[model samples]
Target: MKGQSRRRVLQAGAFAAVSGAAAGMTGGRATAAASATRPTSIPSARKSGGALPFLEGAFTPATKELTAFDLDVTGKIPRDLDGRYLRTGPNALGLEDPRAHHWMLGDGMVHGVRLRAGRAEWYRNRWVRSSQVAEKLRETYPGSAPADDFACNTHIIGYKGRILALQEGGPLPYELDGNLSTLRPYDFRSTLKSSFTAHTKYDPAADELHAVTYYPTWDHVRHLVMDHTGRLARTHRIPVADAPMMHDFALTGKYVVIVDVPLTFDEQAAQAGALVPYEWNHHHPMRLGVMPRTGGTVRWFAIDPVYFSHTLNAYDDGNRIVVEYTSMPAPFYAAGLGSGGPTATGAPTLDRWTIDLTRSHVTATRLDDLPQEFPRINEHLTTRRHRYGYTASAAEMWRAYETVDGQIPDTKFTNCLVKHDMLRSTRQVRRFPAGAGASEPVFVPRRGARDEDDGYVLSYVNDPDRGATDLVILAAQDFTGHALARVHLPGRVPLGFHGSWVHDA
Candidate 1:
């Protein structure tokens, strides 16, 4: 923000060499050939003021793919628990300046652990092969390759029969094996053309995967619909007007909710070699567009300024659509990344935004003042009226961040997991010990779960001081109680973006 090219932090001195080698490469190529590429680290390409906070400490990248068998468990694992827990983060490959680095601009690495019959089987980590990565991997590059490359970092999910790692505004998705190895290209059977978002929703009734995606070349954001069998169903271009970075969206029983925040892609910034191409442009004007699930007329509603990527849940509550999220004064750009940003908005506070369908107006009310984020709920309750909501403490979310200046400011990473009872407006919190941090809570329904809260909340707990990471599983109904099980891993896992559970049949 200090100079005309604030984003040059990504290009200029830091990325000049790396980007030069990467050349025209961007996003990533998720092909079978990429799987053969090896991961190499750059001796240089580090930040001056102590490698951006994310590339250090808990956010440090792990080199080897250590395989641990029969992990030590602190508590009894539920007999019904069966699946692999996988998460992804921007674990940068090598050779770049840390000074111009943005936390979200690194290559993708996925950390995964498997469980079966109440036993912890194994743990593994793999990096998604982006176009920038092949040069680091392929000692001898492939002669020809696909043009659509991807970062495949931000998020991962198990859809239909595939375990796909995804990133917003990139190639389709990267397919990973059950062991978290063998990364390959995925495009819903060659159905996708350009891009997809990090967050995609499923409609059990219709067995359809839905997402509103944005690409640099597209003038409008388009909705992607895939059938239950993982086949592309339809693609409809929505006229949101300008190209805004739309991270996550919500689904009502009949309508899809899209939030057009201030973050937008800048061609000039990108051409300048800024790794993180998007910048906040208030001129874009923030708005929520409500359109039918099948794609038709959109009822647009204007709202106050807030940049929240993840929404807990949204449903058709009578004639009003109630959407819940951790709304902040501004996006994380204010917290760190650079200076002269809107003053730190404080923690992202949980709030409920009610959209009146008939009147086309939005009414918002604060649900809780305690900053919390990554709101999740049981999949069965999505798009329908229900009660339970889960999240991590907002303080712990950005604990490793630093302002443009070289100062270790006090930051709060969600050190606790919380459950929000929407109907009653009450909350239950399960806090970790001092100096410990938690990951986003992924809700897993019990074998015969009857009630909305009848499930287990799963998250990774990292204790850097002790040098260890544990997958902590908590009974949803009794959140504050001891974890049902804490599957401990061999080493510390860098703080990451997101993950999901792939339940075994």
Candidate 2:
């Protein structure tokens, strides 16, 4: 059984490494009167667009129907690293790369899961065998063709008994040690980016290891502080304006917290870049910034006028600084210009937000709307927090029409899984009425289930007009009432950008 669950997660990390409470639960300390006050100054024109006040309806549906499970393991979802900005479609039925491959794509194997006695262990991110990306994609695209779904982009963090692995396509910062698979090369002067697309953060109390990158030809946010054997101790720069970037960032101790989203290179080249010259007329503004974990000075906070497609989780809820986004409502600038103008024919309402960085602003919430003529927002759905609190997944926009025989909304779209409970703030929208395909969810946590509010949530729903794909499971405390089973899968597996669940002991 996987060598007795990797020796019971190395004997429960040698009994929690002598009980420092799992290294203070992955280390992070806050308090200097909560980072020396000074929060409250947000409104760089709250992005204008007044008239939108209507709160009251925090989700309520659970009539009763909970029971889910179907961990069918088949496997096939990982391919994309050719970069000319990577593009491929027509086969695998029309693959489309969703936000950040594995969301940071690799660094301690994208820290996903690791339980043990209850069981689960999955790791992927191959191509180190004297690398050369499939012989340079067959000697420079001699008729392009390579997309059998490979996988990597960060992962491998076991601690105490050791297991590092965070090799970002080699430039610096590499370590693979699942108990000694020994793939050396760990330098760490930071600013490293050959492809593991930065988004890492570890600070077992200053043992340090942070990351950030996003230059877009100098919009600024280079920051990289390392240690814990990776070396490089500091590097700075955090000036943000037409590039509020950083969709995900957090580090409690010295306080990092970056949850930005002010991007508009003509709306990132109208939904997927291609006009260059740094988006001529520029207009990327989504805000929430804070810095100081040793690189002083930076404090931005603006909200309203959102249009984020994914990733936005910043925390430190010890008196506010929550942040969690997945917003929608802006795209009609020729629908982000995928060619065809008139804001590319409008429609995309889906809303969500919850910022409060100590009162700097933000509190718009209104999930349940994506029929605005398919404006697209299933950018791989992801927003996390657990122990029984927040959870998210919402990508519904089907519209398949060849002359329509049934499925139709924009031609077959699916993505639904929304669990929330910000201390009873409400929310639980699950789905499977026979349609779903956007994948990016994995929240096990049931072992010793005496009702720790029960738990289970794995996903990867597909049907792309019936090529087929499934691996569903839900019921994290009755997610909107029941779906608990589905394991189909024999072909078609493209819909990946993030996955993690390595627990089996």
CA deviation > 4 Å runs, candidate 2? 1-131, 134-137, 141-254, 257-291, 296-312, 315-415, 419-424, 433-437, 441-461, 468-495, 499-505
lDDT of 1 by residue, 203-305 (tens): 7777888988876656889888998668888888887655677778888888899888777767676667655556667777888988888988877788887
lDDT of each: 0.68, 0.34
What TM-score, to 2 decimals, does candidate 2 have? 0.26
**lDDT of candidate model 1 versus the reference:** 0.68
Q: List RMSD in Å for every model shown.
A: 7.1, 24.5
The candidate that wins on lDDT is 1
In order of appearance, the predictions have TM-scores of 0.87, 0.26
Writing each residue's lDDT as its tens digit, candidate 2 over 89-187 gives 000101122211111111121212122222222211122211222242232322322121122222333323333433221133334443223354333
Candidate 1 local Cα displacement, residue 300, angstroms: 0.8
Compute the lDDT of residue 447 as modeled in candidate 1. 92
Q: In angstroms, how far off is 47's CA in candidate 1?
A: 7.3
Candidate maximizing TM-score: 1
